[model samples]
Target: MKQMTLKTTSDLSLAIAKDRFSRGTLWRFPARVPLLLLVTGLCLQMPAVWAQQQETPGKAAIPQESPFGTYGSFEKLLQAAQGGDADAQVKVSLCYGKGIGVTQDYEKAFTWAMKAAEQENAGGASIVAGCYLQGKGVEQNIPQAIEWVTKAANRGDVMAQYNLAATYYEGLYGIPKDEEKAFFWAEKAANQGDREAQCLLGVCYLTGKGVTKNLEKSAYWSQKASDQGAPAAQRNMGIFYAMGLGGLKKDVNKALELWKKAAEAGDSEAQYALGSCYAGDVEYYDPDKIYQNMPEAKKWLQKAADQGHERAKETLERLFHIKASS
Candidate 1:
């Protein structure tokens, strides 16, 4: 058996904020009612009801009743939002931004989201920051986005903290790359029990980015995030176990198990690593299973290659070329 050298690799975590919208209410007026009359009645009553609701913005929005039972409705939600309900305001913002029950209106979404943020709602502030970042319903303003995200992070919003950390790390949207600030924000989110941040902090420790290189700390944070079912963390832990680095005992079986879990979760890197192991690239590991199952190597390698993994692509090309020639 040929002894193969393992490639040293590091996982760099990138955080991307995802926007999610809430469902809208489903209400239908009786067909017997004149459409004009129904619209007129709603217009006349909605403002007064909205004004009453605005007086207590802290109140939770009441769920609308429908034939399907309790559900969210755009009109009812907007009414509650106008009444000063932060959660409702956020929901209305989502509805407007996503065109849930009304026409897609970025301006309206920005207005409602800003209103919720003004009330010091963490989620609302995060959404506002995301909107500013992406120019979803407002003009793209990096400074404003950073300010709103900072507020949300200060309010202990884990995702906001993670976003801020990534922003600092990547120097995105005119933000200067500052590893120290990145580490600081990542630590804050990690302390708040954000698994992504924990994994990022582990990477930071391993790379000595804004901190001293410490394998033990790397292993510690990676294990913490791994225990939370973070695929990236699991993959990193698998690498550590395989290489006996980060104060972990070398355990090929454990490495395989972790890689399998991460691979199943669609992690291309883990798929590549698993493929490498199956191809007998992991030094000192048993090669019997791998030798008996070359197709398994190709399967995992193909999966990784399909995801645009350069190394996997190179390996697979070389592998098949050699097989064809033989």
Candidate 2:
């Protein structure tokens, strides 16, 4: 809803883009906050300028418009960036960083993003924090990254809050572990409908990390996140249904259904669940007889084993006599 403006540059620098990306930071961790790398394309994309290359009189044509981003042609986006829309400023920053409708310029991206952040926009502030964290346009500064992200979290940026929660939860980035802080931020993001945060909040409640363990609360949050297609939540929801935990009646069929969804979505744990269950290890009560003979048992189990799930690998060897080398 806001307009943005920025200094226009005709500079087409694929070399610059490549250089920035060469140094770009994208990290994923099973035990820590993910640095929001999965949100690469959450912003609105410009039209299909990607089909045609824009050539300058003396400059080589820039890369095709990235399918990943930008909302309009470069000229129009620049017009908006040059105005003063905080949201638009962030989008322009995304364009510059991603080489969407225009050439990549990390410095320009940082400038535009910071301008929006200065206006107290939560999304812009979070992007600035990401830039600092990743050293996209500036030197990597962990303290600066923490400061900016915390500021954005305080302003209720969902991603920022989720990142903060995960960081504190895992004691990552040199920060001391603080379950209270983790629970606090996780709750903030979860209440705002962030599925990942919802999944994490469920974990917190289930484990009693920052509050008393509450099965009902855990199941509630897990179901909420599962509805949004969160793999982790789906995995947990399956467990709840299978065990009849959290006030739910025993429903092995529902559990299998949820596990199938999670497994198909590439959740290693869910894959293991389906595999082990089908292999007759559930040896949990089942009247439906969705047994391993469906040939799903080995397939899902092998998928999990491929991901280095210890239990899955062991089960394959123990029951199926499948050798590890195979």
Best by TM-score: 2
Error of 2 at 11 (Å): 55
The TM-score of predicted model 2 comes to 0.77
Q: Scored by Cα lDDT, where does model 2 land?
A: 0.64
Q: Score each candidate by Cα lDDT.
A: 0.65, 0.64
- The total number of steric clashes, by the backbone 3 Å criterion, in model 1 comes to 7
Residue 274 shift from truth in candidate 1, angstroms: 1.1
CA lDDT for candidate 1: 0.65
Q: Model 2 over residues 1-326: C-alpha lDDT tens digits?
A: 11111111121110111211233313211111121221344232111111011111111222334432344365665677688877667767767776666778887877887888898877667767767776878777777877887888888776677777777876666779899998998899789887767877887877787988888998899899889776667878888887787788878789889989988977777888887677667646454656544367788878989877677787777777886543
